[model samples]
Target: MGRTFHRYKPQKIFEKELQTSEFYDCKEKKWVAVIPKMKYRFVIALKSDYPREVFDAPKYYMMKVVWKNGKEQVFEADTKDALGDAILRFRTNECFWNNLGRYAYRVYLDWVNKSGRLLQ
Candidate 1:
């Protein structure tokens, strides 16, 4: 139905939530919401080491996200600077789980193919 990229699909449905206490400045002993709202992310399932030609590429790293209000999003992973750095900028607290998530990492040489099902 949709753009089939390497057999990646919605196998599992879950959202990895990131929550933390409101930040409180030392000088100002008061707590404040980070954004005055809650944050949510999604998790989807896809194939591992999925062949290139599937999406007219060599491989794929697909992901699904469920937003707050129940919305689904699917997209590919972009590799420009560094994957580790990307994780650091986003999931700093849960970066440890990056290497153990549904995100797929591939290259022309050695590659990593895994889904949320197998990894998580």
Candidate 2:
């Protein structure tokens, strides 16, 4: 039995692929990357800032949430109830007492509870 191998022809310089830019202007051969003006959400791990050895027994998950138009909210809690209260403080500060806010609060509540729903 014999086998035949096929080789692809080398592409010309004009046919070579190039990196694409979302903000590129092909006609002008220029690109200006655009940064979004709005920030929707952020989950920051505040615990990583401290070394593990600093704690006798780490009692809290230090965390931060940056939500809607660059507002930042921070919390440190060991228990589910504490976390819920912290989140409530944030929600209150942001004036998130509306119906939509309640739904979002539920989601955040579910996340903060290690055992079960505390804010519900």
Residue-level lDDT of model 2, residues 1-120, one tens digit each, is 865444332221111111212243445655455355323242323233334444443445434545444575555566545655665665553234331234334545545463354533
Model 2, position 87: C-alpha lDDT score? 57
lDDT by residue for model 1 (1-120), tens: 777545434334223544433454434645556665534454533334554445534433345544435665454544422332443344443432232222322221112222222321
Q: Find the candidate with the highest TM-score and give its number.
A: 2
Give TM-scores for every candidate, taking all chains together and pairing residue i with residue i. 0.29, 0.40
- Residue 25 CA error for candidate 2 (Å)? 39
Regions of model 1 farther than 4 Å from truth:
1-15, 20-39, 47-59, 78-120
Tell me the deviation in Å of residue 109 in model 1: 20
Measured on C-alpha atoms, candidate 1 has an lDDT of 0.38
Q: What clash count does candidate 1 reach?
A: 5
Positional deviation of residue 61's Cα in model 2 after best superposition, in angstroms: 2.3
Weakest lDDT window of 10 consecutive positions for candidate 1: 104-113
